[model samples]
Target chain A: MEKIVVVGLGLIGGSLALDLKKRGDFKVYGIDQNPTHVKKAIELGVIDAEISFSELSEADIVIIAVPVNIIPKLTQKVLDVVSNETLVFDVGSVKNEICKAVENHSKRKNFVAAHPLAGTEFSGPEAAILNLFDDKVNIICEADKTDWRILDKAISIFKKLNMRIKMMNPIEHDRHIAYVSHLSHVSSFMLGKTVLEIEKNEEAIFDMASTGFASTVRLAKSSANTWTPIFLENKDNIINSLNEYIKNLKEFKDLIENNNEEGLKESMNNTNYIKSILNGLK
Target chain B: MEKIVVVGLGLIGGSLALDLKKRGDFKVYGIDQNPTHVKKAIELGVIDAEISFSELSEADIVIIAVPVNIIPKLTQKVLDVVSNETLVFDVGSVKNEICKAVENHSKRKNFVAAHPLAGTEFSGPEAAILNLFDDKVNIICEADKTDWRILDKAISIFKKLNMRIKMMNPIEHDRHIAYVSHLSHVSSFMLGKTVLEIEKNEEAIFDMASTGFASTVRLAKSSANTWTPIFLENKDNIINSLNEYIKNLKEFKDLIENNNEEGLKESMNNTNYIKSILNGLK
Candidate 1:
């Protein structure tokens, strides 16, 4: 692609712009509602220039990396402006909403709904870094809805970024992601809230936070603006995941309450199976 | 300190042995119900030799680093066999039971109760490494019950390991640690369990586990042997923390269900305060 436009110059968008620009294969421009982010993206050399939505007409590729709540409308607007040959895709956490929003659009064939499963607790333009998408999984939902050429372009770009690709239906993608990714954020945030509520003395937390607590609560630091929409947009799956999580927590509580040492040991032993799964031993 | 006996040569005990041995100021010996750990500690140079409980009489310091359920009884046994000048201490996660168990002993003055707040997800003698306790906090409980000289010896040894000391009552320590340390473990394990249950394809978890999930679930990989007793021993505090944590999760769920965007944003915004707290931004 000769020209590319990255919307919402935040962690994913900014990082993509930086990497694409560094490769010298694409002329990268950024579009953000936040003027500060637009300015910072330029100052940080994340993009070659700032461009308006109208510039989508000249772009060979357009990437929407906005929050899930706004991704649908943004994707639609980009689709309206892009040329027939231009490939438009989103890096949203939730896929079903955006996929359905543009399913019937005239330029639907140009839009590919994608979710790149990679991020840190940090957010915003400055939080972006080089090669953030390297060796990560990029899930493309409803791939059949997009034209073959558009899908090929996205596959080529993501592969160039060293990402592995997987294809799934939008509904299935949302359900699985809600359990694995979104639920983790909820558990982490609540853990932080619970501990901070009880330990009013901040030094106690600072002194006692082992590597385990630090790692577990790291996601609690993620931006509220970024995650609120994700949890809200993917409400049904999130609620289901939350209900299951609460059930597990209650079962554990009951085991502890009854002093069922054997039962508690079994519960932990089963969960410790996570070690092998996480380590890819499974 | 001339000679030290480190009971239960697992992560904490083994790490302590390694640090002390590195100093070349003490001759550290090992004891564990697990012969594998005892043998490994010797092989890893974590201890100079493996010794029986009967050898406790020769040690100037007796460090009990066993699982919480075994700690109370083992601590009392160590106190019974140690010399009056010996500084005996238990590094169990929960401290109240161990403190109370030795409260009426004639040699109570020889015992110090401590919880060193440092560990990795891994376990056993093979998991031990040098300087694990460096700059970590060592919480000493019920110090007044112990002889001042014994307390001084305990403090000096931790200081030599480059650990800072904090003093608190066992009850307060248990309550606070249940929130900061214990709750994180439960949340992480449940997260791992929930994800593993929902995502039947283990490859999805391995492929999509970003830095956030990896860090958030890091504690789930910890040994069940160490954590099961901790959950049971500090059952009340853990239950209380879990209750609060579940309440927070439910509230978040409700907000998402109602599409109460403002509430979701506020809750996450409040929890985001952890960012500053964790980074010591304040």
Candidate 2:
């Protein structure tokens, strides 16, 4: 049986461990700096056992699923210890810094930079669920930089997890993801803040909140610990996206204030194009 | 069987007609300036028949489910033709103007001002679905202005559709809904526009967009015809909310630019309170 060690037993890590375990005859071990998460991941069957960094050499695979801010350093640390045969990958949202950090390392080809475009607003081991990545897109950045053999092994693993593979450079991945994923989280969180700041009557706000509001604000409930790092690591791309978002918002505000019904309707109609594109998504 | 006439055969009106038909032996009729909507409503069985405004006198209950811009005038028109015993209501998103429009009408007591807190992102008669209003909130504004008998009938009907009734004044309804409902639509539309404007690569965006993005921008798929009037009708409150929303977004952007990780996390943590409130929703 193959041995797999999953570091940082949060939603992405714990879920990966559980799904990988069910897919093959692997002894999945978990590790987390938070002791409670380690205990819970073991208790919840998210991992077969809890393992330490010292034991990483015995594993056939090392999965780094920590927050993005710590990922570059942690990837280096994991690569330093893992045997040449072990497949090492980090599943962080932002990929550029991590990819750049290991560019000149002796074990650079041993690491595969990958991000599975999957998650819920909830975090921690308890948030882990079966098939979380099933049929989802898994973007592997700088695939050419990884050794052919290591890349092949990573592809097979992702296949077993039922994910579709897409290859791109780290720079492209960060830019697109800033627009599609990170910006949505920021927009939702700020919307939540605006409503919370103004609506003093909590009961009234909750009662009046329709399905539309709930859906639009759903991402506002995501964990701060998980996202703060993402915002910082991908700050440039995210800042660019945020500037565009704010400019559009201000433009929309002007339309409403000026009673530009035609302009507002045209803007909304143009955006309705998203309906068709998103319909193709899960 | 009581005759229930639903005007504007869009999602809200059409769904109400279908749900009302299923709950009782009501002969539901629909009216729409859009002949396609009227025909579609009849074909979808959302309404039993099509009727003219002249036919409203025959109805025991008349529902004006048109756009907010036209709702006040159409509601007053409906009142002019309805019998003294007939119950009339408008389910537009904005309430203050509609309420004020009929405030001094001879038949003011016959109209119940309402906004059912339920709908899908989709619009038109085909978007109508059974149980759309089930377990949702029905906000009735200015119940005091409605005759006791008419208010009682509206309450009973909402109960039959499996909704909880909350009474509010027109001013309060518009103000609160600006935060919880209208503001959400604006933010989502602007977010969609921003992404569409910047990402130029539609295929790339659709591939990378996770469920979080899907949920946050779902309301962007809502109809321009349905929402244009809503934003215009309640411009003051909507504009106010947008200002606050834009301010928050700018502040969040600045936090990211300055690398203020702690401030960003604290903001997200505070907004997580929405999780509890939304959990109570369907």
Candidate 3:
């Protein structure tokens, strides 16, 4: 069996490993800098075996599922050790930094920038759920820079996982994701913080919190280790998105404070269009 | 059989009618100013029959499920016509206004101030579902102001629906709910508005928006009719929550803009406490 090496045995990597192993072709090797994750992943049967960085030379497929800040350097390190025929990809939220980091690598064509836009708020090996990637979007950036055969192999794998593939350039991918994904996390974390700060009685908050509050602040539960890097690495675009969000919030606050009922209703009605958009997504 | 009249046949009212009807001892009557809701509610079997507002005089249990701004007037009207033995309640998110409105009414002791603390994003009778109130929190504000036997009747009915009951004063209920429930809606609406503003290409957004964005923005699709009055009626408390939310967002924005990595990580870690809180709620 061909070896598929997965770095970072967290939610994304472990989940991908579990699903990929069920395909019954690749010998999945799980690797993580955190020994506990590596040990726990092995105990949970998330991988065929635990492997080391030096063992990557035999990997036919190398997937990096680390934090965004670690991805660029790790991608470079993997490319240095992997076989010439290996297909390498990094499943990081922010794409520009890693894509730019590998832009001038001699083995650029062997690497693909793949961000499988799938995850839950939970992380670590125990959160390795089956079918997590099924029916989710797998965004491939800089595919034109990858080897044709290698890209085809990656496509076949993603198709087997039941993912919808959309190809975009790195800049467009980063910008859109910064707005759609990263900014939402920032908003949720701050929302949770604000509520937790103001509501002194946790039980009172617990009693009053409806499905709406739970859902809106859900992403605030995302891993700090995973998200802190994303907000920083995608700082420019995320900051722009946050500024826009704050401006809209300020406008909403002013409207609410002044009892601008018309403006408030109008804005809410417009955003209700998201109902159709979300339905379409479903 | 006791007659139970539900005023305002929206999601909460309609769902409650369905569940209450299943309990097999009450004749449920649905009433709404919107004739369409009444008609659709009848078609959906969410009600036994449509009743006029004047019929509240004969009601054994009268529930005022209208918007917060209308609840004060509607509760007063219901109290005006309710029999001495009638148990009147208003399912409004903000309790202070309505509680205070009916405080001096001759039938004040007959009225229970309840906020069921349950709902889906969709609204209207069309959105009604069976068991929507199952295992949910039913917050009764100013229970002391209500008659002993009447509060007991409400508690028994809520118990039949499998809900947990909590009692709080009107002021505490409104203030805490402003933080937990109302502020989430504002944050979500602003999130949807922000993304909708920045991502001009809705198709791109539809593709890249993951579960996090979807969950965080889900409340953005809530009924404008239901929410406008809420934000306005709870203006003081809601604005306080909004201002705090905005302040947090600004602080987050500053951290990202200035590359304050430690602050970013610490904030996210702190907010991740919500994970445990949410898990506990489950």
TM-score of each: 0.97, 0.99, 0.98
Taking the tens digit of each residue's C-alpha lDDT, what string does model 2 give over B1-282?
A: 999999988899999999999998799998999999898888989999998888889999998998899999888888998999999988888999999999999999999999999999999999999998887889999899889999899888999999988889899989999988999999999989988988888778777787478888889999999999999999999999998998898999999999998999999999999888777764
Q: Which candidate, 2 or 3, would have the higher TM-score against the true structure?
A: 2
Interface RMSD of each: 2.3, 1.2, 1.3
Instruction: Evaluate candidate 2 and give its CAPRI docking class based on DockQ.
Output: high
Candidate 1 lDDT score relative to the true structure: 0.88
Clash list (residue pairs), candidate 1: none
lDDT of 3 at A54: 93
Candidate 2 stretches greater than 4 Å from native: none
Clashes of 1: 0
Ranking by TM-score: 2, 3, 1
Top candidate, metric DockQ: 2
True contacts kept of each: 0.81, 0.86, 0.82
Candidate 1 per-residue lDDT, tens place, B89-168, comes to 88899999998899999999998999999999899899999988888889999999989998888888988999889999
**Which pairs of residues clash in candidate 3, taking residues 3 or more apart in a chain or in different chains?**
none
Q: For residues B73-163, what per-residue lDDT tens digits would candidate 3 score against the true structure? A: 8788888998999998888888889878988999999999988889988899988888888878988888888889998998888899999
**Residue-level error in angstroms, candidate 2, position B197:** 0.7
lDDT by residue (A1-282, candidate 1, tens digit) is: 499999989998988889888864899999999999999999999999998887789999999998888999878888888899999989999988998899899999998888888888888999989888888889999888889988999998998888889998889888888888988899999998888887898888888886367778888989899999998888899999999999999988998899888887787788788778777421
